[model samples]
Target: MTCKSSTTPVMGIHLHDIHSMASKLETLTKNQQLDQNDIKSILIVIDLNPEPMSIDDELESSKLTRKEFAKSIKKLAELKLIDWDFNW
Candidate 1:
């Protein structure tokens, strides 16, 4: 159950170099160019996906509280980074 990477799991696939991904995400946020809704939605996908992350795990890896993480996911979903249906 160890992903050994930082990118959130998707469809049981663990993206490599999670740290870099996170950095890019941070940059996106800093630029204020990313859609807030999209951020929330992406967080939602990460939260609801079948990955084995606990709230504590998320805190440890993503430095976000459970509530904050949930909120962020909602934003991502709105942006369409993640779909509600399991199509992709």
Candidate 2:
């Protein structure tokens, strides 16, 4: 994803850039009730799996409980950050 700043437009964001941005955002929002682990898990899943992953597979890989994973996924979806389809 390319981000446009006031000065210039960033073109072609890579995975590393996304991770860095997320980390910086997390640090900037210290008082926010955001779960760093959940963000990390989502990034890891995106990095590790090029294809769409099942909910169970993502939960197992991220080591998050069903509830936690579901919550995170819902939040991510609400933010329009991830495009996921529930086949099951």
Candidate 3:
């Protein structure tokens, strides 16, 4: 699916993006000794949105419970993988 933008044609996250992110995460997981839950959480966030999502928005979009979402967000933050913008 393509994103609807007036001037420029923006491409939404695709299968390739997901695969690439997963592969990278897999390597990170092995190196960091991340648990399955952590990996799944990261994958969920990546699959849902490419840009930085508000905590509420991400929780709404993902299948994770509130606690799980919070935990995942904390993990992502700790890894410096996400750029948090409260203003967004």
User: What is the Cα-based lDDT of residue 65 in candidate 2?
Assistant: 62
- Report, for every candidate in turn, its global Cα lDDT versus the true structure: 0.42, 0.44, 0.45
Candidate 1, residue 83: Cα displacement in angstroms equals 2.4
lDDT of 2 by residue, 1-88 (tens): 1122222232433344444445544564575755655444343223333348654575566565655544544544554445444433
> In candidate 3, which residue pairs get closer than 3 Å at backbone N, Cα or C atoms, i.e. clash?
none
Each model's TM-score? Answer: 0.35, 0.34, 0.32
Q: 1-88 in candidate 3: lDDT tens per residue?
A: 1112222322344433434444556577668866766444443323344457644565555554555544444444455444333222
Which residue pairs show backbone clashes in model 2?
A: none
User: Where in model 2 is the C-alpha error above 4 Å?
Assistant: 1-58
lDDT of 2 at 78: 51
- Higher-lDDT candidate of 1 and 3: 3
